[model samples]
Target: MFLLSTILYDKNHVLQNNILTTLRHVLSNITMAKNEKHSVKLRIWFYSGENKVLGKGRIELLERIKETGSISSAAKGMKMSYRQAWQMVEEMNEFSKLPLVEKQLGGKSGGGTKVTEAGERAIIAFHTLENKVNAFTVKEAEKLKF
Candidate 1:
């Protein structure tokens, strides 16, 4: 009777271990599937010769400037320095056919910045291109292997 009880205990312990192992495998696979389903994102930047024409970052900066009406404010919103923001605005204006950002000096109404018609068009075009590229990459990502 003692021997029989010991054998039964060993069998039960073995079954429990096997069940735990299977559960772990199932849970791991579930986690892996969740990770695998994550979507892919794409960013694009346009350039002419060696200078960056427009991209997500610059477009966003332009949008921010439009919203705040000040290069300094926009830089603050984006956590960038005023000088850096000024440099980017200068670069964009220099690279494009038309000046994208217009600055007004301090006066009765104080100073501010404005996005020109051409700048607005640039933002729209960049976003449109970004959307198309993102769609293409997402579709392509579905076929990629680990």
Candidate 2:
């Protein structure tokens, strides 16, 4: 009776360990499946010779400037320094055929910045290109196995 009881206890212990091991394997596979999925990341930049003329950050800055009508306000909204924002606008203006941002003189209502017609066109064109490129990337990403 004593030998039989000892054998039964050992068997139960082994069974518990095997069940635990299987559960761990299943959980690990589930975790891996969740984490192993892949996607494509792409960044688009328009350049002039060696200088970068436009990109996602610049586009956001332009949109913010258009919305807020002030370079300083736009910079603040984006958590960037006013000087940096000013430099970007200057570079964009210098690179483009026409000025992207224009400054208005102070008046009764106070002076502010404005996005020119050309700037509006540039913003739209960039967005259109970005969408097309993103679609292409997504379609290509689906073909990747690992």
Please name the candidate that would achieve the greatest TM-score relative to the true structure: 2
Q: How many residue pairs clash in all the candidates, one count each?
A: 0, 0
**Model 1 Cα shift for residue 38 (angstroms):** 6.5
Q: Which stretches of candidate 2 lie over 4 Å from their true place?
A: 1-34, 105-110
Model 1, stretches more than 4 Å misplaced? Answer: 1-40
Q: Estimate each model's TM-score.
A: 0.69, 0.72
* Clash pairs (backbone) in predicted model 2: none
Score residue 59 of candidate 1 by CA lDDT.
90
Query: On a 0 to 1 TM-score scale, where does candidate 2 land against the true structure?
Result: 0.72
Cα lDDT of candidate 2 equals 0.87
lDDT by residue (1-146, candidate 2, tens digit) is: 53444456675577566556767777888888668756789999988888888999999999999999999899999999999999999999899888898987796468878999999999999999999999999998888867
Full-model lDDT for every candidate: 0.84, 0.87
Q: RMSD to the native, candidate 1?
A: 10.4
> How far does residue 84 in candidate 1 sit from its true spot (Å)?
1.0
